[model samples]
Target: MSCRVGSTSSAPEGLWHWLGSIPHWIYPTALRRDGALWRQVVLWISGICLMVAVTGFWIGVLRLRWRRRYVGGAFTPYRGWMAWHHIAGLVGGMFVLTWMFSGWLSLNPGEYFAVRGPTRDMAV
Candidate 1:
């Protein structure tokens, strides 16, 4: 029997790794029923996530005034919840953007990490 990825949509259980050949109907090895295109799906999803992180960082920076201060000479006009948002966005947003960027880079969409197969000269 061959093992398959779990749909996770209906299955209450979390996830499972494929250690050996097992029937897919019996047990799935993934969280979704993405079939063989799971990697591609994840790549596209990662791109969206990266864009969100970038937008968040951009907003965080724009919300703050550098040269011109607020009424009380404050760099930010936000107060209470908004103030917390500004602080977290300025600080946490950086970390989130960095993490998403690194993950996107790791995907190697430009074939930068491509490997060449054995040449004809190589021994059989």
Candidate 2:
């Protein structure tokens, strides 16, 4: 008799199994094999992205405040270009912040959330 935790077949059976299979489909075997290296890379990238989002938020705030104080209306430095820049920065900054935060959390999930069972090993 054989015992299986999530599924008896090769295909994932439940939400947990589907979630576990994500890394295998997304990341390359080489990256998965060297978990330490992959983690370091993610940390560095997430850090950089966080820094960028912070700086962008600061710039946007400064620009908006300056325009409101001096110009007394919606006055962008570059007019049309600056308008688009502000819109993109405001919307895209949220996305960058969230994505980087999630990436950082993924490095050591046990710290933030409970982890069950033994860690999965890379097939390669």
Highest TM-score against the true fold, candidate: 1
lDDT of 1 at 81: 91
Mark the regions of model 1 whose C-alpha exceeds 4 Å error after superposition. Answer: 1-36, 117-124
Give TM-scores for every candidate, taking all chains together and pairing residue i with residue i.
0.62, 0.52
Runs in model 2 lying further than 4 Å from the true structure: 1-32, 70-72, 109-124
Q: Give candidate 1's whole-model lDDT.
A: 0.67
- lDDT digits (tens) for residues 1-26 of candidate 2: 12236455554344455456544333
Total colliding residue pairs, candidate 2? 0
Question: On residues 1-79, what C-alpha lDDT tens digit does candidate 1 reach at each position?
Answer: 2224565433323223333322332233463465435556556778887887788788778878888888787788888
Q: What lDDT is obtained when candidate 2 is compared to the true structure?
A: 0.64
